[model samples]
Target: MNSIDKELLIKMYMNMVKIRRFEEKANELFLNGEIPGFVHLYIGEEAIATGVMFNLNTDDYITSTHRGHGHTISKGAELKPMMAEIMGKKTGYCHGKGGSMHIADFKVGMLGANGVVGGGFAIATGAALAAKLRGSKQVAVCFFGDGASNRGTFHESLNMASAWRLPVIFVCENNQYASTTPYRTTTSVENIADRAIGYSIPGVVANGNDVFDVYEVAKAAVERAREGGGPTLIEAKTYRIKGHFVGDPEMYRTKEEVNEHFENDDPIKNFKSQVLRRGELTDEEMDDIDKRVADEIKEAVEYGRKSPYPEPEEIYDDLYV
Candidate 1:
């Protein structure tokens, strides 16, 4: 009833599924000694990536966080290459030198995923500034967690984007925790979006667990920025279902908190219900999607498993110019 096209809606769902399956496979690979690095799973934040990326294009750019497989897949990078990269393959986007956290595929406008907590904000802001100066209409999106909101660089990026009228959107996935630390204990602001007032930009908060909610909000922000309206601050209320990293036990939180969010507001489940009840998709279609994603991930795992590690000379290749 929302006038949304069924195919495009399903496309968004597929992207989220791609990310979910990829991250799950990565987790397995890491534990079994295949993907040899610190792997952070983006289990609970798929909707945020799917929603924002649904409105992006090749000219547009995005900055990512440690938990970035979702962002990468949502931007259209093939699953095989990503898995291969984590496996240290020469065919990887980074030639396998920039494993997990440092992965990037700029050809598709994935600036890169930073290992540093707040590193991406400044880089994305600069990319936006470049776009503004060149008179390019492309928008730059910086995806950071709630904890990064308190970083000095985030504030600086916001002020600069506003002052220069850069086409940018700051998407804060306030997933309630940052590496086992509760977000509420860190930030004083009632809403992370409220910080936009300091820079005179528009701000909005949305239920991030709902893909459609984030999609609609992100579309508006992207459109506004494209029209030379400067930046927008969008805070999406979501959560990370898994541990902060593979080794993290997540002792700071309780089983109840995790169960409540994952079981009640799971993005994939909510999307399935809406698509079904809205008559946008058949049960068979949904099942097909599940089957396809499972197969795609299976192939990726095999590719990652067979992929070779970076050659000794390859290590120095990606370091310099």
Candidate 2:
């Protein structure tokens, strides 16, 4: 933890807070009928995105999962554009076409959040290949969930990445559930990182709730990839505090089980505790960060609301190259 600078530590904390607040606000908007599509909230998994993405440069590429707001925010995407995209406004990243699961900012190297499970594996791999071909030191990161690890694309991507020594990092956000399915029931291995062994790549697991822990693991992996050391599969063992999607009946898990995670295993709470314990940030500073994040989200929502919708004919605009 001492290896990370104080400014970066605070930035990571602030980014986590931003992601939490943004997801909460998105949940509110969805329930209020302001947002049109289903939203997969990244409420409890903010630390994984914050920690991992903080290690990346703007030129580095990242492919996101369906629940990707945190990834986008952590990668330095603007909140107004993200909120606008969720609201299907013309000012969005995709001019209102790419909705909740598909917002992208190529300038910031966010390839796009995929609605399809395991969709980002190939994209990230291809980006890594391109970077290698271009003689660029850029690395590509693919963020996926436990469910995605079961997909065929995951194996294929890992094989190719390992064979070529591609500059890629495969981050498995093992939130313990694949939609409503518990990871234990569907996953054969005790940890998803174990699967990376088959491909002869380094596999590491980190306490996803602890930002420092995640940062430490990701920093090494990212550094390895940058140095042409090939891909690393990082299994971030965290919990998804929210339902699979907004308005989910959540009959798969018991109320008591959910309550326990919410009460004790919250990532943000754990992160704040770690920071405070280390005397890195005072309570007053944490409170200020929270306040600023709330204000930013408020402004983002307002900006989304005020933005115009695309014209009917505009749908065909970005269709061609």
Candidate 3:
């Protein structure tokens, strides 16, 4: 709060708020069968995406996880196409060919959300290597969960990145539970960031609920990547508010656990409080921004609902050169 400027602080708050509302609406639509395919909502983890995305340029690429709606929005992707994609409309980013997990906006530098665990680690590493070989200062941010940290691709990608000094930031969104199983059961290390030492890269951990904290850490990592320094691993400790996915039965954990994070450690609420406490924004102004973002999401859904579905013949449009 004290570290960020008023404009950026307000913007960070706005982005996190936008993602939260959008995902909430997504859950409602998905339950109603308006959206096709399952979506992994990034409800309580908005701060990590918003803060990390702020450090990137539109030209700097990022690869996302299945829970990628926040990444797309933070990367400046339009809401209509994203919703349209989820709804399986032709107007969507993937023209209805790819649903929630595969929707991408390379125009905005989102490489696409990966469905396979630990897949994007290698993809973003390759992108970074490409950029480095081409002598471009562009950096790549690879977003994955703590569960991926145990995957072989994660270690391989980091090893390659470090060996060649690739410009990439491996941002691990450690949201406590990895689909009902907590990290304590699966991961031995108390801190996921500690794994970076094996790769000989810098590592840091930040409170994922605090957008300001994430932004500061991500800024340093991005600067390091841009300056041709080797990769950095950032483990953002957060909480995922929703179930593993839509329609998940509460078999793994208790309601009390999820409710605690939603009510207490909610990232969006925390961001607004930090900004308002600093007197950077009045409640009235924040309300206005909230209204604006809500209206946008509303229109986005409307546009997707009214837009035409994909034509039968157009299925082969992007299939070949």
Number of the predicted model whose TM-score against the real structure is largest: 2
Candidate 1: where is the Cα deviation over 4 Å? Answer: 1-3
Residue pairs with backbone atoms closer than 3 Å in model 2 (clashes): none
lDDT of 2 by residue, 99-203 (tens): 999989999999999999999999999999999999899999999999999999999999999999999999999999999999899888989999999999999
Checking candidate 1 for backbone clashes, the offending pairs are: none
Per-residue lDDT of 175 in model 1? 84
lDDT, candidates in the order shown: 0.88, 0.93, 0.91
lDDT: the better of candidates 1 and 3: 3
Off by over 4 Å in 2: none
| TM-score, one value per model | 0.97, 0.99, 0.98
Q: Cα lDDT of model 3 overall?
A: 0.91
Write the residue-wise lDDT of candidate 1 on 120-201 in tens digits: 9999999998888898899999999998998999989999999988899999999888777888887898699998899999
In angstroms, give how far residue 64 of model 3 lies from its true place.
0.3
Q: Highest lDDT among the candidates is held by which one?
A: 2
lDDT of 3 by residue, 128-205 (tens): 998999998999999999998999999999999999999999999999877778888989898999999999999899
